[model samples]
Target: MIPSTTASAAALELASAYQSPSLQSHSHRVFIWAAAYAREHDIAYDAELLFVAAMLHDIGLVPEFDNHTLSFEEAAGHIARVFATGAGWPAARRDRLAEVIVRHMWPEVDATTDPEGHLISRAAALDIAGKNPDDFTPAFRAEVLAKHPRLNLVEEFLTCFKSQATRKPTSSAARAINSNLDSRMLTNPLDAN
Candidate 1:
């Protein structure tokens, strides 16, 4: 079984490797929201594991492959293998997070069997439904409310949106991604004469 510590590190590594600053920030926000939701609802889950899984759930975003027809089981299994091998995570914990990630994409599947799995799945759904970067109108609010009734996600998102004005992206991270891009461009400058 993959160690929990290893799983945590793998999640952190995935977050660090994300290319888009906006996407990374969104990932961070989703994790925070998930954690908050868990506490708010008095849901019993391994908060650390759930948070890690939620944060890194979309690591596949880097490749941007079309897996529309892929079953959640397959996608989750692939993610588990990827984390285990790519991040040196152990098999057991990777499998756990894999279950969470896979089931998250398809909520119709049974979710109550595992606490962490349920939380992560719900958190990801809430995140996707509330992805209005600019506006969250009444229709959007109603949609999220109806779609993710467990967490009262729409209400929480309202709270989150109001508070977002106080938050800003980390400048250091922005600089790091930019520096990495600059180095890559220097090495393979398409416009170089």
Candidate 2:
């Protein structure tokens, strides 16, 4: 159900070029999960925006895009903004895409205010932290996993976050680390099941 657009194609290309295999799969899963949730809830969202944002949400975690000073999310936002501009998006739409990427790291995003942001946040939370495995049925989850395997995502993500936190103590990665994100990742039922 990906929105096929020039912007989305560019996003996918960039993701494949920059992200590791596991990270690339994670990006795809994020998009699929967000789209599924929005569809199930009858939420109206900008599919193209959400798709592009999902493809690049964690881009900054990659060494090529990682910023020494900015948090990974923020760095990714900046990257998406430039990418959107190159794709000929207007300023407001570009900013919205960037905002959605940045907001995915927030604890919560109001659906009324930004449906794409809310969907991405919730979807990423479910995929990464196993916050709501029941949101999707076991059969659906199995199908998704079969299409886009998890690979070495958990260990890889844990390592990335730990490094990010160590380098940027005030980043959201640091906050996640403070909240025992590692334990959550390790003990997530999604992986165990």
Candidate 3:
């Protein structure tokens, strides 16, 4: 079964309230992709934790929470940590989840050091940029996307990242926006044929 818990549900609720419909859909796709990848590769992962991480990964992009002082990843990590703490997650697990959220913005993550983090990072990369689009079977990708359609994700993400980069030019989001916004926005992963 897809991993879920009270904590994960709460995270999803928070995200749904604050995030756009497109972003919420994207977040769900991230979880689906991560879980599917873990299953296909025979990699063990905590579904509940991955669910929470994927759902709240973009919480910092929410306008009410975005202060433009910290990087979006850092802000999102802080939000997730607070939620995890209130949900009675132990420090170690909470920290791991936070790391997963923060590291999702990395250009690449080493799976050896933090498998969950790496999975989420790669999943977000796949959803946002279509990186390694062929890593999974075409049917698997189709199933995930069918459940959580893109909803014009490329334009939505570009708009979000551009706003963040414009507001916080020194942040990692800005760096990423400057470097990858063009390619990512232009290329549609679902269009692979």
- Candidate 1 per-residue C-alpha lDDT over 1-193 given as tens digits, one digit per residue, 9 for 90 to 100: 1125765666666666752444454455455555555566666666556756665665543434213444323443476567656666577866876777665555443434776766665655445443222233355444434432333323332333223222322322233233443343333211121
Ten-residue region with minimum lDDT total, candidate 3: 184-193
**lDDT (C-alpha) at residue 158 in model 1:** 33
Clashing pairs in 2: none
Count of backbone collisions in candidate 1: 5
At residue 183, give the lDDT of candidate 3.
87
TM-score of each: 0.52, 0.98, 0.93
Global lDDT of model 1: 0.48
Q: lDDT of all predictions, in order shown?
A: 0.48, 0.94, 0.84
How do the residues 142-192 of candidate 3 rate in per-residue lDDT, one tens digit apiece?
Answer: 887777888777787788788888989998778977787668757856755
Across 39-134, the per-residue lDDT of candidate 2 in tens digits comes to 899899999999999999999999998899999999999999999999999999999999999999999999999999999999999889998889
Q: What is residue 91's positional error in candidate 3, in angstroms? A: 2.0
Better of 1 and 3 by TM-score: 3
Candidate achieving higher TM-score, 1 or 2: 2
Best by lDDT: 2
Pick out the ten consecutive residues of candidate 1 with the lowest summed lDDT: 184-193
Error of 3 at 138 (Å): 2.2
